[model samples]
Target: MKSLTSIIPAPPGWYARWRFGTHRTVTYPITTWALARDTGSEHTIVVGVDTNGMWPGGDDERPGGEFLRYIYEPIEAGTPDDVFNPVKSPADLASVG
Candidate 1:
């Protein structure tokens, strides 16, 4: 998997066959979220995936798989946070590994 900071744009529907162990098709941009781990904080990055394998668009040459940066509020330890919970960007979060 590409690092969150290194995720550049790519063609649409490109992630359809990107491989997620199973034959999973990323049809919607809301299909998944990246959970970046850290010691004090964690990040849930919202992303978009191919709805169809066909890359139909006016800008075929432009990078695809582009996503909006997800902004959220900070969470204290022992607090519950869902996918929609607010948190800092992955770039600001330092990883344990």
Candidate 2:
């Protein structure tokens, strides 16, 4: 088992990975909205096991089993705001043209 703790918050688009004994590893990336909400806070983190290039061992090596230990920290409670505006429809574009 492994544990990670951080006092500084991760920034949007930031990513990190951990490798265990050159065989397994995990990675995480920060969310965009969290960065916007708290420029100084590090809230989001993820943990996963890396099975890259490993051969499947039939029933013992199911896809679900590969990522069973992966964990992603959730964002704080809040209504998620849309980050992008709605695009114009084909009709709207034709009218503009």
Candidate 3:
């Protein structure tokens, strides 16, 4: 049997997708989890996958087409409480379309 992590690297949760033009689409499990800090700001790291689903030839032929995508968004600055708290589980992640 395959490990759960291998099947679903992230816990099931509300996800978000960002599209860049007609060629790229990025989808990730959304959360308020912060991974680092920069001076007065708390930065949240989110890992996602990019897919060129509409590409005529498909993504397999594109160089490093299946590469992982990492994003960092600033959550807050200066105050500890202002920093967004981590979403502990998929159930806790906010619902979205």
Candidate 4:
């Protein structure tokens, strides 16, 4: 897997994407998750995981498993939570979309 914005390498059963946001005149693409919102984090961290249908580990609109996104640091991601926590500013949310 790879980060959506930075194309950084990710481990198997793991993936990374950015929150729908904006900063300093740059706008980040909108997504569905409670990932990092800062510009630096938006570019590097913000990750999640997934698996085949039988293992129950996917999170897109797809059926079976769910790939849970996160609100964690780039260096640490030992826990897993799937609560959709909104972290972007109202303006950022409105503007990015």
Task: Give the best candidate by lDDT.
Answer: 3
**lDDT of each residue in 1-97, candidate 2, tens digit only:** 2123332344443333333333444343423212111234554343321223111122233333232232343444322221111364656433421
- Give the better candidate number (1 or 3) by lDDT: 3
The residue-by-residue lDDT of candidate 1 on 12-91, one tens digit each, is 22232221223321222222333323334454343432333222221331244333233222333322122222254655
State model 4's lDDT.
Answer: 0.31
Summed over model 2, clashes come to 2
| True-vs-predicted CA distance for residue 56, candidate 1, Å | 20
| Model 3 C-alpha lDDT per residue in residues 1-97, reported as the tens digit of each score | 1111111233334333444344544444443322322334454333332222222122332443343333444434222221223544545432221
lDDT of each model, Cα atoms only?
Answer: 0.29, 0.31, 0.32, 0.31
* Deviating ranges (above 4 Å) for candidate 3: 1-11, 33-97
For model 2, what is the error of residue 43's alpha carbon versus the real structure, in angstroms, after optimal superposition?
25
Q: How far does residue 55 in candidate 2 sit from its true spot (Å)?
A: 31
Alpha-carbon shift of residue 71 in model 4 (angstroms): 15
Q: Cα deviation in Å at residue 79, candidate 1?
A: 32
RMSD of 3: 15.4
